[model samples]
Structures are given as C-alpha cells and as structure tokens.
Target: MNGASALEVIEAHDGTIDLMVTDVIMPEMDGPTLAKEVLKTNPSLPIIFVSGYTEDRFKDEIGDNAHFLPKPFTLQLLAEKVKEVLS
Candidate 1:
C-alpha cells in the first residue's frame, strides 16, 4: 500500500498481518524504524527488508529480529528468505 501519513502505517493494514515486506527507503518512513514500531503491537511479527544497498547499509538500524532481502531479488529468492526467516 502507498502509505499517506508518517505514522499512519498502523491503519494501512487489516490487523492480522503475518509478515511485513517493506523497502529500506520510502517517502514516509524507512523500513527498520517502521519494523521496530510495528513490533510493539505484534511482538512475534516477521519483517523482511528490501534495499539496493549493502547489508551494512542499515545494519545499525535493525536489531536481531528482522531479516534482509537485498533489492532486485527474484520472487523465488524473496520467498526463500521469507521461508528461512519464518522457519
């Protein structure tokens, strides 16, 4: 979804979210900050970050909970990373 507000992400989803696949850079917010806040509500949530930058690009922003899926990944690659994270 194209998020409209800075913190309006909570209302963007239907509330039974299983996974959050977000870009590292967006017009509203970056992925890692969003993930941290999203976890406050769903502690068991899984996040997959996508970006063209290197793994070290946002390593300082993300904690141990989220997984990284570098940009330009194939659907299969993204799926595999998600499966690996969920597993």
Candidate 2:
C-alpha cells in the first residue's frame, strides 16, 4: 500500500505497530517521510526500507531504529534483517 494508506492503517490501529517495511520511493509519500511521521509518535519503532537504489541514497534520512534492505533480496535475507532489527 501507499504511505498515506499505511499511515491511515497505523492510525486506525492506535499506532501499535511492532515493525514497518516500506519502499524508499513511493507515490504518496517517500519512505523517509513516512518514517519521520511514524517516528514522531513511536520513536522506537523498527522500520525496514527496501529500495532498488543503494542504501547510501537514504543514509541521512534513515535514523535510529530504521534500516535499509536493497531490492532483489531473498526470503532468507529478509528474514535475517527482520530478526536483526527486531532484536
């Protein structure tokens, strides 16, 4: 879903999300923007941003508790990232 829709979902759920996985580039809102918005309320929320571009592209925007996963990743790698971030 798009960032706006995802934000709506988060609001609907009372912002009690454990983790978030988003793409770096999106239509409504970019990943970093979404992350900033979400982080406003849930500061410790862990977010995983996936993109076709390199991580360096978003280094400054991605702050604490946020991570980057390059595109074309395997299920194993995704799982590993999730585990690493959640931990």
Candidate 3:
C-alpha cells in the first residue's frame, strides 16, 4: 500500500500494529518520512524499509526503529527481516 493508506491503517489500528514494511521511495511520501510521522505516536513501532538503493543512504534517516531491505528480496528474506525486527 501507499504511504498515506499505511498511515491511515496505523491510525485506525490505534498503535496496535507490531511492525510496518514499506518502500524507501514512494509516490506521495517516502518510507523514512512516513516512519518519522508514525514514530510520533508509536515511538516503539518497528519498521522495515524496502528499496533498490543502498542501505547506507537511509540508515541515518530511518533511525533505530527501522530496518532496510533492498528490492528483489525473496519472501523468505522478508519473513526473516520481519522476524528479526519483531524480535
């Protein structure tokens, strides 16, 4: 889903969401920006950011609660990342 819809879902869930997986670059809002906004209310929320770019570029932007998963990742890799972040 897009960033705006993701934001709405998170709001609708009232901070019950365990984690969020999003793309680094999106049409309306970027993942880091979305994460930053979400963190305002759900500071502890874990986020996984997916993109084709290098992880280093987003490391500082994403801060502690977020992880980077480059594009072309497998379902297994995505699962592993979710598990790792949720842990």
Candidate 4:
C-alpha cells in the first residue's frame, strides 16, 4: 500500500501491528518519513525497510526497532529478518 493509505490503516487499527515492511522509496512519501509518522502513534512497532539502495544511506534515520533488507534478497532472508525483528 501507499504511505498515506498505510498510515490510515495503521491509525484505524485497534489491535497491535506486529511489523511494518515498507519500501524505502514510494510515490506518496519516503519510508523513513512514513516510519517517523507511524512511530508517533506506535513507538515500539517493528519496521523492516526494503530498498534497492545502500543501507548506509538511511542507517542513521532508523532506530533499534528497525531493520534493513536490501533488494534481491531471497524470501528466506526476508523471513529470517522478520523473525529476527519480531523476536
């Protein structure tokens, strides 16, 4: 989903959001910016950022609750990262 729509869903949800996996580059808003907005309401929410770009570019912007998954990653790698973050 797009950033705005995702934000709406996030805000409307009554239950917990275990994780948010968003693309680093999106049409409506960048992933970091979206994460910042989401964190305002859900500070402890886990986030896994997926991007084709280098991780160094956005490393400083994310918190310990976040993880970076570079593009071309296998489904196994993504699952591992998600499990790692959720754990």
lDDT on C-alpha atoms for all candidate structures:
0.77, 0.87, 0.84, 0.87
Candidates in order, TM-scores: namely 0.81, 0.91, 0.87, 0.89
Task: Report the Cα lDDT for residue 21, model 1.
Answer: 83
Q: What is the Cα root-mean-square deviation between model 1 and the actual structure? A: 2.3
For model 4, the superposed segments whose C-alpha errors exceed 4 Å read: 63-65
How do the candidates rank by TM-score, highest first?
2, 4, 3, 1
Query: Ten-residue segment with the worst summed lDDT in candidate 2?
Result: 7-16
Local accuracy of candidate 4 as per-residue lDDT tens digits, 1-87? 788888888889999888999998887877888999999988888899999988888787765557899998999999999999888
User: TM-score for model 1?
Assistant: 0.81
In candidate 1, what are the lDDT values of residues 55-86, reduced to their tens digit? 78678897766788887889899889978987
* Clash totals, every prediction: 0, 0, 0, 0
Residue-by-residue lDDT tens digits, candidate 2, 1-87: 888888878878953689999998988988899888988888888999999999887788886556889999999999999999998
Candidate 4, after superposition: displacement of residue 63 in Å?
4.2
Which of candidates 2 and 4 reaches a greater TM-score?
2
Better by lDDT, candidate 3 or 1: 3
Superposing every Cα of model 4 onto the true structure, what RMSD results? 1.4
C-alpha RMSD values across all candidates? 2.3, 1.4, 1.6, 1.4
